[model samples]
Target: MDLTPESNQDDEAVGDLSFDPKGALDAGDGAVLTRLARAVEAVDPVPDDLVERSLFAITLAGLEADLMEAVYLDTPLAGVRGAAAAARADDTAPAEAKTITFTHDSLTVMISLSPAAGGRVRIDGWAAPAAGLDVELHRPGVDVVTVASDEDGRFAFDSVERGRASLVVRRTDGGGGAVSTPVIEL
Candidate 1:
């Protein structure tokens, strides 16, 4: 089933039957221990050597932490910070990670980047007002600076380093603010 926002409400109707443990037994063993044994046997286990090789690859490729985090989220994982974040977003609308915004009392920013030859990069930024505004580019370890926007409220980075970078947009009006997009790899 598609795990869209609309379908999540249907989870309520399935009820506790979804967590039944007896259903795990592959065979109809009358005894609990036999059922458990049969269930364990029915599952195929990953070999120790294969597991070690996979772990090596994950660590070598920098995927070990991300994989572990995914596994943690799939289980009954919890901590004070995670619990608090979940509680606050229960009724809040989910925001797109790729986009940010800034308004009179708020700000929004969206980013898309592309790579080019000769250690160059291109960045695309959008803002609400297509009026007097300034955009800036911040490369790793570089001093913060501002950029100019075209008439259409768009700015571009002709050629930037192929490393971490950030974009910020400001307005000429007194009420304008800036937004720093997440670190993007060029």
Candidate 2:
């Protein structure tokens, strides 16, 4: 599948959405997304001003007018806008939200990040061939952990740090796979 961000064909309106990378479907007003789309179309490298322009468009639309918002940095859509990540899913729902699946040898795993307790990051993972697995968080620092799953093959990182992180899983057989959840700055 073509995952290039430049593909406007993916912008085909899906039930009113104009194919948001952040997956913010337009229910009515297209101002913010329209400006985003135009900016994306105008240059190979999107200008930095587009963020302010998008925020301005959102402001004009009166969306969350009081609090600060932007396409980058901190924004509601940035939190869970995994539509690009969704393309890797085995199945696609109309909602356009999905998980990434990695398989190695007899092991198959699906992983995603969510808000953890105490304002930490949550690593929710499911694996096949239920066994002891090593989960590592890689960023500027490395956190190594090993976890054995229940009969259902589910594991989690409840107190993971909030920032860009990747999950690497190692199986007992020494073969493993990794999936990088989209960078989320909490």
- In the range 113-154, model 1's lDDT, one tens digit per residue, is 444445344556665447566766655466655777776677
TM-score of each: 0.40, 0.40
Assess candidate 1 and give its lDDT: 0.47
lDDT, candidate 2, 65-151, per-residue tens: 122111223223623434423422323333332344555445566666554445454567787777666655444344445555555
- Top candidate (lDDT): 2
- The lDDT of each candidate is 0.47, 0.49
List pairs with backbone clashes in candidate 2: none
TM-score of 1: 0.40
